[model samples]
Target chain A: MRRQLLFTALGAAIALTSPLAGAAGDELNFDAYREMLADGNPAELLEMEGEELWRTARGPKNATLEQCDLGRGPGVVEGAAAQLPRYFADTDKVQDLESRLMHCMEAQQGIPSAEIINGQFLKGERGKLAALVAYVVTHSKGKPIAIDLSHPRVKEMYDMGERAFRYRTGAMDFACSSCHSQDGKRIRATQLPNITKPEGAAEGWSSWPAYRVSNSQFWTMQHRLWDCFRQQRTAEPVFASDVTIALSVFMAGKGNGAEARWPGVKR
Target chain B: MKKLFLALPLALGLSGASADELQTRVEQMMLDSFKANGIAGLDRQKQDAVQKACSGLTPPDAETMKKLEAAEMATIKWPTDGNFTGGDWKEGQKIAASGRGLTWTDKTADNNGGGCYNCHAMDPKEVSEGTIGPSLEGYGKLRGSSEEVVKYTWGKLWNSKAYNACSDMPRNGYGGILTETQIRHVMAYLFDPASPVNQ
Candidate 1:
């Protein structure tokens, strides 16, 4: 894979330039360097694989996920991710992209619900959930988030998510707001996006289903939330649970109207 | 007049119940939402008294904070040998810079990173250090070891919340994030003249 080559090349590059980064009073300009690498991001590979999986038919039902209705309708993935964690009338529950995909996987493709829900994100080699999420989110590229808060369930979820955002109960006493509420904050070399305001939330919300260079795999919003809780030292949230959906509703609502840039690349 | 007084108090209680109910629901949902997997377990959902107080809409009162601080202070296990800066600076550097441990991905909990670089500038040479906490670049150079300074520094490392109730820093000692030997190494990384942090 090109990513494998990129990693090899980068390793050599780091080895050669190790002396410069090790000097006294040297600012690595790592953020700018990351920006340069972002241009030819290898997320394109996952996007290609996702497109194939989305269109191809597999599983017991032997049917494509193309018929899986996101928010707009069946097979209408365009801009659907942005509007999600919204209430679906049929399911009668607010659902994010991963939960909805799980629904379609079981209902349409005949995959066992347990099979999909059991895997912990990033605990092992990347799960199929990450691949499927990458496929679905790529469809909504270059669109604005449009969460529907009118539905009663959606309204309830949004309220719960707001509380969840500020609900700081962990070994370290961290909430989503602890790290994300403040702007211009970083954890080591990484700059954390503030999810409090629309502009900040836009940057935060719309860039998941991203390719991670560290592990050479893609991550979804579900995995992203899971990691936040991990770093917060909270209980690992179950896949597609009410709490995860509630947090999604809160973030998606905050990030409303921001452009959806998925299959994103991260260092 | 009697009916009005009773009704008003009932209404106030009902309003209070709504927020209480939401809190209970979210807490229960969190308990139900996660399961024990790998090294992480459901017990992590359970919050301690300090965690519970900090989770509230308002900060804990000074009286409550003093009690919590006292409890936290008791958890710090001071090195019996009375040597704080005896560990190797190279080993200390590795522990201070590491940010991985206790997550599901990790196989074991031993040798967890202090994650100090994530929030503090340990050395002036590193550009990538975080700014959430104050810089400690010349920590030893600035403050030479009086018995008072050494003891205070060791206490701060053991339980930061013992000094500040709502510190963003983890109760590294009380929370069991690092071991006594590891903390000693970190202390050396801070106090040793040969360490880059002192330079």
Candidate 2:
């Protein structure tokens, strides 16, 4: 009995001391780890797959997305992703990359937009859409973010987005600014960037279509935006909604001149 | 015999002194080993006054804690329009699930992710979520959208330190990690009945 009691005490002591003892002075060596993994980012594979999807003619209409215009000329995919959330004269609406992809899937491939939008991120034809995004965004890698705000609609959307950003409601009465409007702040160990500053906006706006280590899946900008709503415990924004595009525009515009780093790796 | 006994006591004292010296040396060595890069700088290693007080210490006195919280609250930038709760919830949902942007390799121009799921369980249906923060499922159902609630929520997001001086929650708005519109969408996602978070 005494031995068992001593063992239990020892176990309790070990548990209590382990985390405190281990965490005393060891900080995360992020730079060294990042350097080691830089050469073999999994985003490379997704980019290759996306390229194939963009060129391959496999839709119901047996058409390819090669002719899709992402704010550039027809069939242009290079550096287009960095300039999206812009007004498309053809659609008479501002669209982001995902929304544009839906348009191409419907117009060129004869596939229904609803079907493509409804499908899972990596399942069926929608998966192909994700791959296409990966490929297109990768082409814009290292390019400067140059979202066009010269258009009247673009300016209007920016204003609207600003208002929406400050709007607060819900059980917790949380607003986006509540978590994002400060500097030198952190949640757990993750530092929160201030979106109001140029450096912060630039740093915060240009990396997207990243692979989430926890989910083991690739996430586009659309997916990234939608998930924020979930945490807010608010209504789920529609897929490719105008408000969503406007927010994208607002963020991208703020991050002007920031280099694009799509298909990025994330912890 | 007297000389030998005196030497043993002195030797013991010297050994204790050496142990303390070793501890200090190790602590200094650890502090010097780190290097800053990109958005992450060496300043991160240094703790604020509140953090230093809290570090390896007991909880702070109420008066000191209140003072720190007040200082943090002063940093909040309230919305100019006085509008709270107008963004579509659907858009908010998209923002919550994303955990992208802001790393050593990431360019200064990229969009940063909220990475909410890395800490909190927002949706009951989501099987994969970290436990760092409390589960936020049914947040709207449990609490209604009121003016006080709305303002508080905004305050929390704009500067979590306003509420809790040493809160683990990030200051999203103040930090520029998220834009105003993105925050609006996130707010909608939490309140909208049709949102997955509510469901």
Candidate 3:
């Protein structure tokens, strides 16, 4: 009778855990299918158009983005996107690619930053900015994510981001950490990566400017961060805001050495 | 009197007035309690056939489950050109990391993210990742470049329900979360030996 009981208990255990064990195989198949569609990504067209916009003189002053400095020297576009959300001495604030781009448009091209930020992603001058970012970010593809937090201001932003990540408030009492701090958590089958660990940070930070399959549109890093704030039920993030850049610094700094894969695809 | 007593038990069993009824009633109550606002509508409360099947007290029976899986398989949208792999891996990595777009507050749906990190571990050095899925550390290394592997990943992303009838994964491609180009880049992030996911 004891032996029979043991066998029954074992069967129950297997039944309970089988779903978790089977999930790995299911995910592998999904990954493979996504791989097959990698070629001829439509985002390429956006990248190309973005490249043209970068060099073309536009805005009130009709200045090209080629003269913009992305922390590298002026006119140097290589690998600049990888080391963003860094401290810019001139601005005296931590800035990422989008914010820095806004500064360039305002100061260099004489276009008001408000006009661009107020517009939608693909509308008016904001669309032009998105294209420019798409073009610029693609150039740094395959490089490692290496945000510099060595500066005191950059470090301060990283610390602020860490605090923001853990600050739990809202109807669901959700912070970024609520969904991202734990391993093996899921909401309606959607897996949530633990963002507190190195692998998670690298994976999370490396893919931005991705094409969202759900909406059939490309998203930039700025848009990506803003959406996170919205999901947290926090106030909508200001476009190219410092808090957003700080979060980028925190994720990118943690993701050191992870290869940059911008313009990624997503479900 | 004797017939009534016999019929009472039968009625209880046939009517499913036990645990199953209680569970369904609870779910209904929960669904009804929530109100739809803005872009979020009552449709969110409605479960599809697959969801209903999965929510049952027991796992789906094998025969019915097989039929559901087949139905999901039919929904996959394979690339027309047959070019399964393209786009720069660097570009792909960015999309995987971002978890943005698709909410009631979103003014527009022009930009969105893959939110891949919400589930699986992709890179070795990074600190934050969710573990709902397996550690994708060295995915390319473990599974070499075989045609079968490539095709399977693409299909899974397109419609996860194809393989597993009640899979928790979002139907990225089928549900229109990521575009073809975006899917391509995410593919590069996974399969590109150069991608950090591979490393």
lDDT of each: 0.76, 0.65, 0.68
The candidate 1 chain A region of ten consecutive residues with least summed lDDT is A23-32
lDDT tens per residue, model 3, B1-199: 9968755655553354554554454344324433444544445544566655664324589998999889888988778887677767787778778877555565554356777777678877554565556677887778876889888988987878788775656667766677788888888888888888877
lDDT of 2 by residue, B163-183 (tens): 876565666776666777777
True contacts kept of 1: 0.53
The TM-score of candidate 3 is 0.54
Please, what are the lDDT tens digits per residue for candidate 3 over residues A44-83? 6678888888788877898888888899889777899998
Candidate 3 C-alpha error for residue A83, in Å: 0.6
Tens digits of per-residue lDDT for model 1 on A56-96?
78789998888889888889877777788777777877889
Please provide, for model 1 over B82-172, each residue's C-alpha lDDT reduced to its tens digit, 9 standing for 90 to 100.
8988989888899889988887667776769988998899888777787678899988889997788888888888888788776778878
> How would you encode candidate 2's per-residue C-alpha lDDT over A1-267 as one tens digit per residue?
643553355345435433223321123212233343455556666778888878888768999888888888999888898888788889988788988989998999888988875565578767777878888888898999988766656655565555445434321224455456676554433445576666666656676777654455778877776665545433445567655676677778888889987767554
Give the docking tier of candidate 1. Answer: acceptable
Q: Candidate 2 — which residues are off by over 4 angstroms?
A: A1-32, B1-199
**Native contacts recovered, each model:** 0.53, 0.00, 0.05
Error of 3 at A79 (Å): 0.4
Residue B151 error for model 2, in Å? 22
Best-to-worst DockQ order: 1, 3, 2
Give the lDDT of residue B173 in candidate 2: 75
